[model samples]
Target: MVKEIERAGIPVVHVCTVVPISLTVGANRIVPAVAIPHPLGNPALGKEDEKALRKQLVLKALKALETEVQEQTVFDK
Candidate 1:
């Protein structure tokens, strides 16, 4: 799906816990997720802090969208 979207001239940033898979599948832009169960937030954190962490992850994804990449790229926190 990500490859198809890019083939159509639309940029996509894939956020996932397994970055290697994203790269192998030809995702041009990738963001590292927290974990498989809760990719957006860490349960060990307080409620508010977890929310903030999720927000930061989203913001990083947005930033990755704005970046130009010649090949598969991973945006790390």
Candidate 2:
């Protein structure tokens, strides 16, 4: 779980379509995703576009990891 991972002193970024669930579970860093079926990428898009989208999400997650937060936070694209 995200909270458990953080409790171990490791930063975690929760990527999900529904942010409220991540907040409920006490995730410190949350990333709002595209959808439940395709949380990280839009399959309808061309392969290149999907790749770019995924890359952006990874970058956002990395940024979240680098930042310090005292409590729950959501990183929106």
Candidate 3:
């Protein structure tokens, strides 16, 4: 699906927690989240902590939107 989208000339920004997987699959724009299963938060953590973490990562993703690059970019916190 992602490759198809790219083939269609649509710019894609992939938001994922895993870095290597996205690159291996040839994703153009990649943003790393917090986790694999739970990309936003961990249930084990407190609500406040989880919310803060989510907010921070989301900000990073937004920052990624402003930059232009030719290769795959991973936003890490």
TM-score of 1: 0.92
Q: Which model, 2 or 3, shows the larger TM-score? A: 2
lDDT of 1: 0.93
Each prediction's whole-model lDDT (CA) = 0.93, 0.91, 0.79
Candidate 3 lDDT, 3-49, residue by residue in tens: 67888987777788777898889887788876788998878889999
- Pairs that collide in candidate 3 are none
- Alpha-carbon runs more than 4 Å astray in model 2: none
- Model 3 CA lDDT for position 61: 72
Q: Estimate each model's TM-score.
A: 0.92, 0.95, 0.75
**lDDT score of residue 56 within candidate 3:** 81
- Tell how far residue 8 is off in model 2, in angstroms: 0.9
The alpha-carbon lDDT assigned to residue 58 of candidate 2 equals: 84
After the best TM-score superposition of candidate 1, give how far the Cα of residue 3 lies from its true spot, in angstroms: 1.1
lDDT of 1 by residue, 1-77 (tens): 88999999999999999989998999999999999999998999999999999999999999999998888889995
